[model samples]
Each structure stands twice: as structure tokens, then as C-alpha cells.
Target chain A: MQITVLAGGVGGARFVRGLLSHLRTRDDAEQTSVTVVGNTGDDITLVGLRVCPDLDTLLYTLGDGVDEGQGWGRAQESTRVAGELATLGVGPDWFTLGDLDLATHLARSRWLAQGLTLSEVTARLAQRWGLPDRGVRLLPATDTPIETHVVVDDGEGGERAIHFQEWWVRHGASLPARRFTVAGLGEAKAAPHVLDALRTADVVLFPPSNPVVSIGIILGVPGVREALRGTRAPVVGVSPLLGGRPVRGHADACLAPLGVEVSAAGVAGLYADFLDGWLVDDADAGLRYPAGAQVRSMDLLMRDTEGAARLAGAALDLGRELSPVGAGTRGPR
Target chain B: MQITVLAGGVGGARFVRGLLSHLRTRDDAEQTSVTVVGNTGDDITLVGLRVCPDLDTLLYTLGDGVDEGQGWGRAQESTRVAGELATLGVGPDWFTLGDLDLATHLARSRWLAQGLTLSEVTARLAQRWGLPDRGVRLLPATDTPIETHVVVDDGEGGERAIHFQEWWVRHGASLPARRFTVAGLGEAKAAPHVLDALRTADVVLFPPSNPVVSIGIILGVPGVREALRGTRAPVVGVSPLLGGRPVRGHADACLAPLGVEVSAAGVAGLYADFLDGWLVDDADAGLRYPAGAQVRSMDLLMRDTEGAARLAGAALDLGRELSPVGAGTRGPR
Candidate 1:
């Protein structure tokens, strides 16, 4: 079976890691291949180096090199380079690049500058992390340099746009976003194999990532939404929200500008057209979901690797229940 | 009074630092200014970041942040970035960039990419080092991207060119060079203020730097040698050699391909056209020199800052002795 996953940073990375852990115990582990399409909306050029926070998070988490405490970045990371950059006043103080993490940016930036596509660079990076050996392939949603910018008040009844990172990292999303704008989204084509991954997958999984900026940004890519809607695969998603609030990150802040309710059911409504199975936290089990989607409730707090694996197992079980082999029709779109 | 110095890396930086120390003890220190024109031939782009070894050495040494033991780079430096790059197979493993040192390259590369000339970037970097407060200004020989390439045997019975750094750092300068070819040198004009610094100075000094690659490369700049020839200021130099041998660096290897003798007199001969005074070690005091230039002998080993100061003091005294006020002619070219 080929599983396609759309991922963001921390939450998405953890969920996929859990999926891998769950698969390791299954007899068909060798037969299962996973393709992850990472969100590039959070990409930014810091100090002339391209930094893809979401992609790096996925790489580190799945490679078993992620910081367990932070759930992102390299384990045993040092901030020597960041400290020096601060002394030199080169980059923003809010966003720090760890010494080990900087190597990834350097390699990515150099390769990009040399005219290699982002997909090609990601593949090279994935090799170093042994992703191929684990039957996993990581790719960017789009090769074009697309960035998510947040529109905010300019403090005098006017509006201004700031890079999403500044809004998310520097301000902690405290500034009310009027709307989110993704620069170059219209012109960006889905990266090589991205649409194919979605179209041919047996199961499509949406990890508990930010619906507004992460998965939404990926869907914004040209043809991506159509691929998801048309794919014969069973599309299952774990809600990022529980009790009208996100467990981590400012997903609520992101959804507020879009006028979407900050709840599990509201998030499922965003994917109502293609979603086959929806898994929500037990606290929101009573909430009504979209029609035609099989709703399931579970203890969704991924407290540890085991907890994450259990949640992943439940989501997979939900996906299998909705798969054509079980009961649902797998008719051509 | 204004003093201009042509410098390279370690030896040149130490000489200028010593010159500053020597001037501090003099009564006219407050009335004097110094300008340093540094060689850019050694500059290379490593892992997409511009690395100016000579300029960085000058900045770190003069700013009191240099690694005293290595005579270059930052103090208390860590090679975490380089180690990570090695693990990722991104950059050359032979050349290492310390975490602290990488920050400088990042800043410089970003500024350059933002359309700032190399001179402008150097001025900003100098501000961080407090160069203006010390009445010192540092400038690159040229703003154009010029690199020195060494033509050596390919070991397949053919000649090939490699970056100067590859020959010096990776091969330890052990490869016998057929010649040195500087890419973009002919078209590169002298950077802003470089010619003026030479033309208007009361005295010009050549520190104990490599004659073939460092100071020699600076002279190769279009108008620089002409400015020296036309300037009325007495030009004095301290020979990099002690006893027909360079105390540090591969000056001898650099000179060999040009068929120049690697001795004090031979180095003096290279600058005979503009040289007004030459300072050599006591061992080479009896060597024959060009008749127009004044010669002085000294215990030229700079064991510490004090010894370097003593040598700088002697060089300055020789310059003053050869000045028009002290019986030497100071007329138009």
C-alpha cells in the first residue's frame, strides 16, 4: 500500500513519526511505502540562506535525530552560529538557527542557487537522513519559492503585510491577522510526483497540522486540491483542534481570519469535499461533522511516542474501515 | 599625517596591530590616520557564503577577536557547522569554517547580494570592529569578484586550474604550480577610495606579507601601482623573509613559479620601482639591493605584540628618514 501524507512542522512531523512507528509492528511494513508532501509556505530566506522549517522538522523527526524535548530541530543542537550571528547583528533575534541545523540551510541554499529544484534538494537531504531506506520519500509541495505572508494592521488604520514567520515566531501570532496571503501560490506548480503521489495512493493522511497555513497552503497549490478530490484513495485526517483550541501552535489565530470555527468539526468542514474519515478528540465527540464523512473519536493527546503511535493506529483503522476493500465504493472519479 | 598600508592576512594584520600599538606611544598619535588596502585575491565562495580570509583576518586581529594561536579566525571558535556539513556531504571536508567565523561570511554574502559593494560592506564590518574609533579605515583592493587560481599538473599529463584556496588549504601548497592566473583581475577596477588612500598619504608601508600573492595581487590592480609611483609619500616595506625564508605561509612556493628568488633582496626587487625604503632581517643586511632605495636591518622575528611594535616603529622611522623633511626628495613622478 502507498500512503500519501500532507505535513507541516512539529505536529505533522510527530504524527508521521508515529505512523512509521505503528507500521514497524505490522507484517506488511515492507510492502508499505509513504510519500510526504511538506508545506513550503513557512519558507523564508534568512541571511541569504533558504530555510524550510516544515521540511527540516519532518526530516529531523523521521530520521530519529529530532530533539525530543522541542519535537523539532537537531538533537544535541548548539546555538554557537546563532550567537555569533546575533553578535554580528546579521539575522533576526527571534528566529535562531542552530549550528547543526544551519548545515541544512547552507546545503539547500547552495543547491537552489545552483539551479537545482527544491524537490531535488529535498531528495538529496533525505538521502543523508536515510529516508529511502525506510521506504519514505519527502518532497516539497511546490518547487517555486512560495511564502505565506500575513496581512495585519499597520497601526494607523492602514494594513501591512509581514512574512508569516515574523507573525508566527516573532509575535507569537499575537497580532490579529486580517488574512493570510501566499506569495507565488498561483504561479507555483505542484512539485514533481506530488500530484501523482496523491492520485495513486491507497490512503491519503492529513496529520494534525495547521489547516489554515500548512495543509491549506499545500491545497492552494495548483491542481493539488483537484488531485485530492479526484483520487480514489481513502482520505483520512486527525483534527488539529480539540475543545475549540489547538493543542500546540496558533492554529486558532490562523483560522480566525478565515472566519472558520476553531473546532474539530469546523476543520473537517474545510476538507468536506474529499475527506472520507475524520478522527477527533474524545472531548469533541458530540460535535456534528460534515455529511458523507465517517467520524471517529479518540484520546488525541500525543503525550509520547507510544501515545502518538496509538493515535496513528486509530486513524489508520478508520482509514481501512472507509477503504473500498472493507465497505466503501472505490469507483473512478 | 596619513599612513597607508597594503596588507594580506596573518602577517599583515599583526603588523598593522603593532603599528597601532607603536603609534599609541607617540605624541602625534591623535593627529595621524591609517588606511589599509587589503587583498581580495584570496576571497572564495564556500558553501554559497563569500569567505574573505584576508579581510576577516584583518578584522578579527585588529578588533581583538582573533584566535591568537591560529593567527586567524575567531577566538574560542567551534566547528559545529563544518562538522555538520561534513556529515551532510555539502562542502569540502578539508576546509573548515568555525561557527563563529561562518557568521562573518553569512553577513558579507547577504550584504553583497543586496547590492552593496565589497567596499561598502567592509566599511560596515569595520564599524563593528571599531575601526573608525581608532582612526583606521580598511578597504579591499577592488570590489569586483576576482579570484586567484593556481595552474598545476592534473596528474593526467595535463594542466588544470584550481582555486588558490584548494591548492593552499587542501593540498598544503605542496603541488608545484606552473603559474598563478587571477580570474577577473584585468577588468576589476580598484575599489573606491583605494587609489586616493595611496595618492594622498604622507607615507605608505608594506607589512611583512606575501610578496607574490598578497601585496603582489594588490599591485596588479590597474591604478594602484601607478598611484604608488606618482604619490610623493615615501613608500617603505618590511620584507616577509627572515633568512631567505618566510617565517609563515607559503610565500616561497608562490614566488617559485614566477622565477623570482625567495629572499629579502628578491622581494625588494619586485617593489624596486616604488620602494623608497626596505627593512630586512640582520641575516640579509649585507645583501645587494636596488640603489635608489634605502636599506635597514632589524631583528625581524615578531615574537609578540611588543616585538611587532618594535619592528613597526623601525619601519616608520625609516619612512620618516626618507621623507622630504629629512633630506630625501619628495617630488612629482
Candidate 2:
């Protein structure tokens, strides 16, 4: 089966890992292939190095190099570089980057400076982590910069714009965001294989990533939403919330800016136009979804890999049930 | 006294530290100022960050951040970034860069990318390290890259050119170099304040650094030689060799390729045209210097900071003797 997943940072990585784990146990597991469309809205250049937080999170987590405790960054990473940078006063003191993590940024920045596109650089980086051997392919949502910026109160008089990272990481997303705007969205076209992935996949999944910044940003790309609506494959989404609160991260803070209620029903409403199946946590079973979508409530607490796999398995089964009988499965590996 | 030292890497750093220490105890020390013209030929860009071995050697050694036992690099440094880079197969495995050291390079590279000259970048880096507060000013010989390349036997009966680091650090300079050439030397002009320091200095001393690569490369810069010869200040040089062998490093290997004999007298010959006084170890007291240069013998082993200070003091006294009466020492602070 060819499974295409739209993902964000830590949460997305966890879901993808669980999906891969779930596929491994299937009778036809050897024939299964996964392609992940990673959000690039959180990307930024820090200290002259291009850093794609979401893509790196997925790559490190899936490649078995992630700091398990933090669910992001490299295992056993040191902040010596950050400390030294602080001494030099070269970069912002807010964002803390680890020494081992810097190697990836350095490599990516060099390759990008040599004129490689984001998609090409992502492939090169993934190749080093042996993502291909694991039957997983990761690509950015768009090749061009499509950085998300939040409009927030400047604490003086007028409102000002700040990069998503500063808004989320530095401020802890505490300040009320007036709205979110993607700087390069109007000019950004989907990466080469993105539309094709939707067109050819047996099923497409939206992991429990932040709706506004993650899946929302990916869908904002020009032809991406149209492609999803036009594809014959069933589209499914899993709620990032459990009992009206995000299972991980501050999705409610993101949702507030869009005036969307911080509930499973509110998240489902954002994807209702094309979503064929929607899965909410059992805690949110009382909530209502749109008419055309088939809603199912399951235990969505991804407390461990096993729990994550079970949730992923539930989403896949829902997708299979919604798709046309023979079209539910992919032909071969 | 205003002192200008032509220096490179470890030896130069040691001499400067000692010189600083010696000045601290002098009655006129408060008036004393020192400028170190560091060799840039040994510099290399590894993994996109500029690595100035000579200037960094002086800065770290003087600023109390150098690995004392090694005479170079950061004290208490970690190689986490290098290890990660190895895993990614990004840069050559031969040149090991520590995490703390990489911060300096990254800062420099970022500044250089912003169109800051190496001299400006060096000053900024030095400021952070508090080199200025230590009464030391470090400047590159030239702003343009003057990397030393070695032509060596490629082990297949044909000659190949490799960077000096690869020749020295990787191969341990085991292969006999056919010749040494400085890339961009013809185009490289003296960095800002280089000629000015030489022009207005009370005395100029050549530290016991590699004569062929360190002090030699500095003199190769177009106007530097002219400034040294034309300056009214007395020029003094200390032999890197002691008892017919280099005190440290492979100065002999480099000198042999240029047909310069690996001895104290031979080293003094290279500087005789500009040098007024020369210092050598007591072991080489019998060796005669060229006609115009006065010679002195001393115990030149810088076994510790105290020994280095004493040697520096002896060089200053010798320079004072060579200068026309009342022309050597600077006015009071």
C-alpha cells in the first residue's frame, strides 16, 4: 500500500513512525511504501544556516537519531556551539540549537547555497539517514520559502509580524495572534511529487499535527487543496485534540487566531471540504462532524509506539472503508 | 614600548604570551602596546567556516582559552559536531574541529558572508574574546586568502597539490614537498593597520615560528617587506631552530624544499636584509650571522610562560642595543 501523510514537527513524526510500525505487521507489509509531505512553514535561517524544524524533526525521529525525551533534535546532542555563539553574541539567545543538530543545518545550507532546491536537499539529507531503506520518502510541501508569520501586538502600540518560530518557541505562543500569513504562499508551487503523491496514493492521511501551521499550511499551497478534492483516493484526518486540548504542543493557541473553536469538531471543520473519514479521540466522541465525512472515535492517546500504531491502524481501516472497494489498496511496492 | 611581532601558530602565540607577561612587570609596562601580525597562509576553510590557525592560536593562547598542553584550539572542547559530520559524510574525516571552535568559525563565516573583511571579522572575534583588554591586537597579514598549498608525490609517481592542513595534519608532512606556494599571494594586499603598525612601531620582532611558512608568508605580502625595510624601527628576529633542529613543527621539511639549510645561521640569513638583531639558542652560539645583523645567544626554550617572558625580555634588550641611542623605548603611559 502506498500511504501519503501530511505532517508537521514532533507530533507528525510520531504518527508517521507509528504508521510505519503498523504497516510492518501487516501480511503484505513488504509491499507497503510511505511518502511524507512535511510542513516547511516553520523553516528559518539562523546564523546563516537554513533550518527546517519540521523536516528535521521527522528525519531525526524516523532515522532513530532523535532525542527521545524531547521528541526532537539529535540524541546526546550538546549545546557547546550555542554557548559559544552566545559568548560571541552572534545569534539570538532565544533559539537553542545543539552542536550535533548544527551539522545537518551546515550540510543543508551548503547544498542549498550550491543552488539545490529544498526538495533535492531534503532527498540528499534523507539519503544519509537511509530513509529509502525503510520504505519512507520525505519531501517538503514546497521548494520555495513559504514561512508562516504571526501578526501579534508589538507590546507598544501597533501590531507587528514575527516569524512562526519566534511566535511559537520564543514567546511560547502566549501572545494572542491576530492572524497567520504565509510570506511566500502566493508564489510557492507544490514540490514536484506532491500532487502526484495525492493522485496516486491508495489513501492520504492527515496526522494529529497543528491544523493552522502544519496541515493548514500544506493545504494552502496553490494546487494542493484542488488536487486532494479531485483525487479518487479516500482522505482521512486524525484530530490533534483530546477532550478539546492538544495531545501534544499548543494547537489551541494556533486555532484561536483562525477563530476556530479548540475542539475535535472545529479541527474536522477545517478539512471537511475533502475529508472522507475523520477520527477523534474517545474523549471527544460527543462532538459532531460535517455530513459528508464518516466520523469515528477511538483512543487517541499516543502514549507509546504501540498506542500510536493502534491509532494509525484505526485511521487506515477507516480510509479503506470509505474508498471504492478495489481502489482501497495499492498494486505493488 | 610599542612592539610589533611577526608570528604564526603555536610558537608565535607562546612568544606573545611571554612578551605580554614580561611587559606586565616593567616600570614602563603601562605605556607598552603590542601588535601581532599573524600569518594567514596556514588558514583553511573546512566545512564552510574560516579557520585562522595563527590568529586563533594567538587569541586563544593570550585570552586564556587555548588548550594549554596542545598549544592550540579551545580548552575543554567537545567534538560532537565533528562526530555528527562524520556520520553524514559531509566533510573530510581527517581535520577534526571541536564544537566550541566551530562557533568561532560560524561567526566569522557569517560576518564574511555579510561582506566584512577578515580583518574586521578578526577584530570582532577578538573583542568577544577580550584580546583588546589584554593589550594585544591581532591582524591577518593580508585580507585576501593566502592559503599555502603543498605539491607532493601522489603515491602514483605523479605529483598532486594538497592544502597545507592535509599535508601537515593529515599526512604529518611525511612526504617531501616539491615546493610551497601561497594561493592569492600576488593579489593579497596587507590588511588594514598592518603597514601602519610596522611604520609607527618602536621595534619589530620575529618570534620563533616556522620561518618558511609563518614569518615567510607575512613577508611575501607585497608592501609588508618594503614597510619592514623602510621603517626607522629596529627589526629583530629569533631563530625557530635550536641545535640545528626546529624547536617545534616541521620547519625543516618546509625549508629543505626551498634549498634553505635547516640551521640557526641559515634561518638568520633569510632575515638578514631587514633584521638588525638576531637571537639564537646558546647551543648555536658559535654560528655566525650575516654582516649587517648583530647576533646574541640565549636559552630560547619556552618551557613555561616565565621562560618565554625572559626570552622576550632578552629580545627587547637586544633590539634596544641595536637601535640608535634613545630611539628604542616608547614614552610613558
Candidate 3:
């Protein structure tokens, strides 16, 4: 299967890992190529070093470098830099940089300074650790930098913007944002491989990543949404929301700002144009989509890599079934 | 009393800490300025962040922010960055950065990007923590970004050039460097206040830092040695070496490259012409100096702030005792 996975942070990374494990077990790994388009909306430049929190999270997690404790940064990390920054009175104190994780950011920043695009940098870094090549590839959504900023009332009546990382990682979505903007999206172009990956895909899988911000932001990139719409392949999306709320993250708060209900149906509507199939949890099987996008419910929690691959396999099967070659297609063929 | 101390690394920083402590205990709350001209030989841009090890040592030691474990960098530091860098296979692993220490470099890098000089950046950072105003100043000896490179035999009888930080920190001075070059020293000028500070000095104290590479390199700066020679103030130097070896650092090896002995007498001879008094350890009291210089012996081991102050006070006292005024001469009469 030629699969393209639209991803966000921890959840996306976890699902990718699961998909890798399953592909390896299936013995058809050589045939399946997984292209992950990562979210860069949470990127920030702190003290002059550019930090891509979500991208790093995905890379570290999938590369088996993630700290087991946090499941975000690398394992065996230390917070020496954070402590020093604190002493210097700089904060979003809640987020800590593990020692092992800093290396990725440093290398990324160094490479970026040397004139490499984010896509090129991502490819080089992934090749360094040899991410599962049997069916796996990681790509950034755009060449131009895009920052997701949330506008919140700055303790008074007036509203100001805070970087997405600060709002998500630091505030933990405790404060509500009046609105959100994907800054620089006007100038952003989809990564070189994104359109090609989407067009040639047998299945386009939207992993259970942040909908309003992460995967949504990737789909918003120029040419990506259009590519998916024109794809001859089936498109399936796994819902990040389950039972009308997020298992993690403030997706509900985020959804409220966009007027999207906190349910699989609500999220499915956002990707409704090209989504041929929607995967929700068994708990939300009772839910209905008015436009009647082919829907199924499964055990969607990716508790382990095996579970992630299981969910991936099921989604792929559903997408295949929904396509012209699938069981649900008309008998004309 | 305005006091200027020429410093290198650990020993120099400790001595200045003592000086800062002594200044605090004075009967009068009047200004007791301390101008520290820190050695820049060890400076190198690793992954492009300028790190000043010795200067930061002095800053952290005096302000109670130093890591007591290593007596350098900040306290409660983490190593997430170091671990990550190691994983990424960056060089000079021996000169590792605590995560907290990286914040200083990152902040300094950021400030430098905004057109701030190292001196201005250092002052701004010092102000954040409220450093003692006895005119506390940390200067980089010169404004130019001159790097020190070491040439070592390449095992095939040819010499290979490596940065000073790599040679010293990584190799642990195990390999011999045929030469140490402070590239661009001939054209370098003492950063604005250096000459003015030295010329107006009531006393000049050379802390027990690596004299050959530290103080020697500073003296190599154009118009700097001249400033010291032309000053009416007495310059007193404390020996980094006691009997024949340095208590810390590979001063012995550094001196060998310069054909100077690793002894109190050797250092005294180097500074003799412009020196007023040379302080050696009591064990090295019999050490001799060149013509026209007085010699004194004291406990120069600055184990803590009290020890630092005592040594600093001793240097100050030696300065007054050797000067024309204290000697009851009419302005060198």
C-alpha cells in the first residue's frame, strides 16, 4: 500500500510507529510506503534557536529516541538549559528540554542556517537514524515557516497573540483563545513531495492528530488539499476526538473557536470533501454523518506500536473497500 | 578603591570571588570597583553559539549561581543538550555544556545578533542578577573575534590544526600541540574600556590564572602591554604555579610551547619589567624575579570566597606597599 499519513504530535508519532511495526510484520513492507506530513504550527524561535516542537516530537518518537517518561523528547534527557533559561527569567516554564532532545533542535537549527529547507532538513535527519524505510518517510507540510498563534485576552479585555506552543504546551489550554491564525500561511507552499505523495497514494490516512491545528494546518497548505481532492485513491481519516472530547490536548476548546462540535461527526465534516471513509472509536459508533461518508468504528487507541499498526491496517482496509476496487463500489467496473 | 584583576579560568574566577567578598566586607560602602579582564583564548563557537567559559565562571562564582560540583557553569544545570549533541555526533564532547549554561550562550548569541558587543551583553546579563557595582566589569580583552588554534602532529609527522577548546578540553592535554596561535592578536585592540581601565587603575592584580595563554595573550594585544607599562599604578601578579607545576590546567604544557618554565619564578620574569610585586605561594617563597621587581609570598589558594578575598586583599596590600606613595617616594622620586 502506498500510504500518506497526515500527522501532528505525540499521537501522530505513536500511530506512525504502530504503522511501521505492522508493516514490518505483514511481510509486504516493501510494497507499502508511508509518507508522514508533519505539522509545524507549534514551531517557535527561543533565544535565537528555532524549535519545531511537533516535528521533533514525531521524529524522536518514531526514531525510538523519545524519552519514555514524556513520550515527546528524547530519552535520557536533562533540563540544564531550561533551568538556566529560568534563571535568566525566560519562560513557558512548563515545557522542559531533555538533554537528548536538544541535539535534534540544534542540528535542525544549524542545518537551517546552512540554507537547507525544512523538508530537506527533515529528510536528512530521518536518514541519519534510518527511520523505517520499508514503508516510512517524513515530510514537512511547507517550505515557508508557518506559526500557529492563538489570540487570547491578555488578562484584560483586549486580546493579544501567543505562539501555539506557548498556548498548548505551556498553558495546557487553560486559557481560551479568541481566535487562531496560521501566521505566514499566505506565503507558504506545500513541501515538494506532498502533492506527489497525495496524488499517487493508494490510501491517504489522517492519523488521530490535532484536527483544528495540526493535521488541519497541513491540509491548509497550498496544493495539498487540491491534490487530495483529485486523488484516484481512497482517503480515510481517524478521529482525534472520541466520545465528544479529546483523550489528550484541548481539542474541545480549540474546536469551540472554529464552531466544530467535539465529536467524530464534527471533525469528519472538516475533512468531508475528500474523506471517503471515517474511523471513529467503538464508543462513538452510534454517531451519524448527515452526508453519509462511509464510516466504521474500531478500537482506535494506539496503546502500542502493534495497536497503531492495527488501526492503520483497518483504516487501509476500509479505504480500499470504499474505492472503485473496494466492495462498496458500484458493479460498473 | 578601583581594582583590576587579569583572569583566566577556575583559579582566576575563584580569586575574583574572594575579591568580591572582600569588597563587600569593607568598612565604607563607597565604590570599590573591580574590572576583570577575562582570558578569551578558550572561546570557540561550537555549533555557532559563542561560549565564554572563564568569564561565565567568574560571573557565576561571585553571584552564587555557579555549579559547586564543577565550580563552573550554573547550579542545578541539566545536560539534555549535551546528550543530544553526543547522539548527533558533534565534536569536542569533552567540553560539554550543561543545559543551563547553554541558555547563557543562546541569550548572548541572541543579543549579539541584535548588534550588542560582548561587553555590553555581559553587562546586561550581569545587571539581570544584580552584580556588585564596585565597578564590576567583565571584558573579553579585545573586541575582535580572534580564535586560538592548536597545531598537533597528525601521527604521520604532519601537523593538523584543531580549535583550542577541542585540543584542551577534548584531548585533556594528552597530545602535544606544537604551537598555539592567537590568530589576529597583532591587529586586535583592547575593547574600548580596557586601556582606560588599566591607565586609571590604582592597582592591577593578576589572578592565578593560566599566565602563558591567558595573561600572555591579553598582553599580546596592541597598545595593551603599553598601557600597563605607562600606567602610574603598580601591577601585582599572583603565580598560577607554586613549586614547578600548575595546581590546575595544563599550564605546564602551554608554557612548554612558549619555552617558559612552569614555575613562579618563570611567570614573575615574564611580567618583571612592568610588574611592581610578584606574589608566590609560601612554599615557593625562595622564587626569584628579574631586576627592578619586588617579590612577596602568600597563601594564594582560593578555595572559597573568604580565601579569594584574602588573596585579593593581599594583592591590593602588595600593590600599595610597592607603590611610590607607600614607599614614601615623591611620585617615583
Clashing pairs in 2: none
Q: Write the per-residue lDDT of candidate 1 for residues A1-333, one digit (tens) a residue.
A: 788999999999999889999989998898888999999999999998999999999999999999989888999999998887787788898999998999999999989989999999999999999999988999999999999999999999999999999999999999999999999999999999999999988889999999999999999999999999989888999999988899999999999999988899989999999999999999999998889799999899988878888888888888888786741334453
User: Alpha-carbon error at B256 in model 2, in Å?
Assistant: 1.6
Q: Rank the candidates by DockQ, best first.
A: 1, 2, 3
TM-score of chain A of each: 0.97, 0.97, 0.94
Model 1 per-residue lDDT tens digits across residues B1-333? 789999999999999999999999999899889999999999999999999999999999999999999999999999988987888888888789999999899999989999999999999899888888988999999999999999999999999999999999999899999999999999999999999999988889999999988999999999999999989899999999989999999999998899998899999999998999999999999999888899999899988889889998898899888887641334543
Task: Judging by TM-score, tell me the better candidate of 1 and 2.
Answer: 1
Best model per TM-score: 1
Can you give the lDDT of residue A21 in candidate 2?
91
Better of 2 and 3 by lDDT: 2
Every model's TM-score: 0.97, 0.96, 0.86
Best to worst by lDDT, what's the order? 1, 2, 3
- B1-333 per-residue lDDT for model 3 (tens digits): 667778887888888878877867876436567888887767788777888887788788767788876778888776667766776765356778777788888777778887888888777677655664544777778867777888899999799988887888788777897888888888887887898888877788898888777888888888889988987788998888878888888888888877876788888878877988888898898866677767888876767777878888888778888777762121451
For all candidates, state DockQ relative to the true structure.
Answer: 0.84, 0.77, 0.53
